[model samples]
Target: MSKKLTIGLFGYGVVGTGLYDVLHKSKTVDATIKKIVVKNKDKKRNISPEHFHYDKNEILNDDEINVVVELIDDADAAYEIVTTALKKGKAVVSANKKLIAEHFEELYELQKKYNVPFLYEAAVCGSIPIIRNLEEYYNNDFLQSIQGIVNGSTNYILTKTFQDNLSFDEALKEAQEKGYAESNPILDTGGFDARSKLQILLAHSFGIKTVPEDVFNVGIQNLGDLEIKYAKEKNLQIKLLAYAQKRNEEEVAALVIPKFVKSTDTFSTVNDVFNGVKVQTAFADKQFFYGRGAGSLPTASAVLSDISALAYDYKYEYKKIENSENLKLTEDFNLKVLFRHPSKDADKFQPYFENIEEYYGNKEQGYFVGDISFKNLKEIFSQNSEEVSFVLIEVLH
Candidate 1:
């Protein structure tokens, strides 16, 4: 260990800057940033050679740099950068879930080929340390269950709905306005982010790789304020959950979707922009990791932890991707149930329909509250030829 460890960063966005600050200021004597690679930008402002660069080639080619840290979010570019760095026999660390989820096996082959580390600690759960937990402890035990409100955006939105009685649109607006969620939110609100984390954890805990699309995934788009109302009445909460379990030692349960949680549960208490993961295992019993799931500093803190550990002991850092088998996603993973039914204590809220004399009902007939099966609902609506024209679906308390 030296006073400083030379490193190269591919992105200068939020996580990149935070990584610079942490490594440069950490109390650790041996860990430090050597050079932060960047694309060509304004040169009028003063910048340190150790602070910036203009090309991916510059970072990849440098011999002084020992560790290649990638914060760039793109999956393809990250693949090229990481593979190239590993080919050159340099350590690589990244926070890209898409890349990790898509190319874990390929990346690890290169890692083991050169005996260099390929680390991705911040790829999941920000600073919660779930990946490491699964890799180290849970793997030893029989991890029967893994269920959590894994996405902060959806969790925050649901929390706001519970507290302020905000509509789906209203809560989503607040999330976007506060920068808690993306404008599209298809990824977070859709539960893809949690699925990525679940894939990585599943690989370690189960000794296999699972594709993003392979794991069962259902987003929060269909769920509305009515379910929130029902959850509240039953002393339950609405949350987007990323879950997996070993059903019979030979079977496994992994899916992402909205769930109604009982008030007595720890998950219901976890609210308002906070994230938590609950793991049920034989030895550890039940453990929960809760915090701000994402942000520059929180994610950076996880990255720095990886950097320090990789710097200290690169020997224990074997590539799991190479040894593990890919858990191919089934074409039809539709189990009868995605998760356990809502607790009996929780309100089973459904939308109600009332016929308000609509001038003989022409084209607008039924409201859609996501609870009903869309296939059946569509069939039912299609048969109404009597100028069907009135549909209204909302929370039926």
Candidate 2:
């Protein structure tokens, strides 16, 4: 906090440019971008050519730059940049969820070893300030569960499908056209994006470390008119949800999957590109966080918050990392699910269910409401040859 805060920025993408604009416009933060490293120097941009640097070393080697902001898309490259900056004893802020989730332990160790701040508030629900809230406000509270619609692309698509009565493909196309989805949106639609965000939250909320592969994740790619109709008939709304719940003092359950949300529930009302997180704690019954989950400005605002905090020498203690030893992740909890498949495939799933509440079938498709353990349901889906679709039934506490 002696000299003016100098920034070493990586990536000149949407969020990166937005951050630059915000920083330049702000009168509070005494920060200036020393250098910006981008992949392509030939790409036309509004920024001056003198401001861009093709070599990352230009930023990494500069002693004046005490803070590095990484807004890159590639997780691998982002990892390299962030690790390098942290090792160099510079404060780092990133929006890369995949990189952070995959290397949480390594990054925490780097923070301890180098004694520098590594903050990533824009990684989870964009502009929601969930991470900071979990790190500060809920630090003393015993959190029982964290559940939400974390991805905006899938949420927009689902909203379109439900309200506009559009098909899955049509909804996806609309999301793409509106810039809510990527050209190749597999990561977003397949639930991997939300899974990564959930993993990051698990560390802060429940003091647990987990990977996307360990979580039971299912995408919305298989949802069709039939499933949408079913949800409407049952007076429900379908949403892609990510959850982390404490099963016991020592055990926690986590997953990212589509669920049938009750029409009356708050989550059901969360539509379009809006995101909602419901945190259940021991003292506080339930608290909800809502915001625009994605977009350049909204996401950039979160990243800027971390940057501003860094200007004040703020760094996360990662208290959860110290208390995570006894927290074990499991998928053994029993849940009520509605499974849909071809009529001929009904018998294959029936044996896995502990109890069946209702069985309905037709020539084209069949579905059943039943109770099944998460482990068994995941196993059944994994072992099956054909694609299987299932949605978690909303349970009111």
Candidate 3:
């Protein structure tokens, strides 16, 4: 029989409290929270104050606590807590995608060195369990591509904008008010959040390790009524999609960008705070995993699943990553795109595209449908022209 887990939980925010409630209510889970570390002292909490501590050593030095659950938002601080836990030979579970994506190589080495299980099912897609599925179920499958709506905050904002006729700003404000987005929502709106998750998935799906800066990602921050109206005219909905596809045997292409999904498509129907991941493999063909991508309870459920797995001595094998195949992540592919900008500045943007397939211009604004290399897309997108926007016409892998 597996040993009962004594958990030292860090961060008492949304998901933290949800985990506490769920762990207690779960009759099957053989884990108990021995200590919870939080920053604030006076903040009202759902649990008793006796269970909370302000110091990291309280949990890190506690030999009885064999599992460390890091749910903090600050990546730097999260790194410290996670590393300390691992060095102390404690199994670790975390939901911080940024920390995992940024220091994946180091964390992987740490787990191997300490010979401890480090599982993070919550970091990728709230309750979807994509990480575990990729690690175990899809270990032997020859994966062709992995793509979907990985971020829920932006999805919520986009859903409200198109479905409820709310403006982008209004929808974003509503998401923040409802706790779907953070107070400073740039991580979600700017596509950084999804990019982090994609980086983590690349290792599991294709055994490719890459940085967030190398991956070109443009989010819904520039989206407005113009794009929504354009989508409606074309019988489509705009979704922020993070995708990775095997271009050939040795090379794989990955990117996160806004795209037009046809009304008949699966992602078009995956609206609100829900996330859908479509994995294409040689054997299974295509399968879609859908669930709540963000929320206190939903995210906590994923975290709790990891805690349960730790009891049974389960950890990610990273089969694809450890395999002999030398897979490389590349951005050399060509993409069909729709670039919308002020008509007056149209000529300035003409040189960026390889060739314009179609063009429409008026006195106010215009759009260009053309093909552009992923490398050039990064160069132009860096200009950060507020008057301009870019969307994938279709994903060509």
Candidate 4:
């Protein structure tokens, strides 16, 4: 018989409340919530006041609480809570991607020093279970690449633009209204959210230690209707893609950028608050995992999966971390780039490409296709930042 797992849950927000409800309903795991920690003690809540506590010690100091499930939004505070719990000899589970990715090495050390389990499955791809699959199923295989539309807010906005013909602002407003995006959705729209997820995946898949700042990421904020129309005319769809591929054993290429994917590709079909991650490997070839990338219940389900695993004394070995021998990351591969800008700046930007062709044009608005190295493309974009309005890299199958 399995032992009953006692939980001290932090942050009674969306995911936290959902986790509480799930634990109450689930019988498969013998777990009980001993206490819940929240910041706003005055916030109105339907749950009983007796179950809520504002102080960290209410959960961290409780000897009966064997597990700490953190569902907070502040990465720095979450890091403090997680490390404190780990030092106190409690198994930890979190859904904070930013915290995990930024402090991975420190957290790993704390887990080892304290001899406790720290699992974070909900941090990436929501309920897709990609972390467990990478940790167990694909651990032995030679993973070639990981490509996906990992952000649902961006996906939903893009879907509205493509299907409803809404402007980017209109689509983003709709996403915010529907609770798909935050009021300050810069992280989602700017590709930082997806970049954080990619960093976590890189550590799990390739044993590389890196941060979002080091990645070559471009968001969909600058995409225009003209670029979308151009892609559709060419039987392609534009998607904000998070991609990581092994260029060689010593180096990996990773980036988050807008790509002109073929209409028939699985990525093009993953639309509207949904996410799909395609894992390419030596043995499995290409395997796709699809599910709701966000929301209270979906994310809660992933957190519970970690809790259930911890109930059985499961912890990530992170074997890839030890096996990797100083593998470097780069974004210098070749790419076919599509650029849209004002005709006045054409002379300045067009010369950077190796081979160039005009796709569509007018006296005011014009677009061109060109072949260039990804490094040079980024440099050109930085140099001519204001002139270029849209850029999309051609997806290589």
Cα lDDT for residue 65, candidate 1 = 86
Best-to-worst order by lDDT is 3, 4, 2, 1
TM-score of candidate 2 to 2 decimals = 0.97
What TM-score does structure 3 among the candidates reach?
A: 0.97
The models' CA-based lDDT, in order, is 0.67, 0.87, 0.89, 0.88
lDDT of 3 by residue, 37-107 (tens): 99999999987899999999999999999999999989999999999899899999999999998999899
Q: Please report how far candidate 2 places residue 330 from its true position, in Å.
A: 1.7
| lDDT, candidate 1, at 117 | 80
Tens digits of lDDT, candidate 4, 329-361: 977678777888897777777777777855567
TM-score of each: 0.79, 0.97, 0.97, 0.96
Is 3 or 4 the stronger prediction by lDDT?
3
Q: What's the lDDT for residue 79 in model 2?
A: 88
Best by lDDT: 3
If candidate 4 were superposed on the true structure by all CA atoms, what would the RMSD be? 1.6
Q: After TM-score superposition, what is the CA distance of residue 156 in candidate 4 from its true location, in Å?
A: 0.3
Residue 134 accuracy (lDDT) in model 1: 69
Against the true structure, candidate 4 reaches a TM-score of 0.96
**Lowest summed lDDT window (length 10), candidate 4:** 388-397
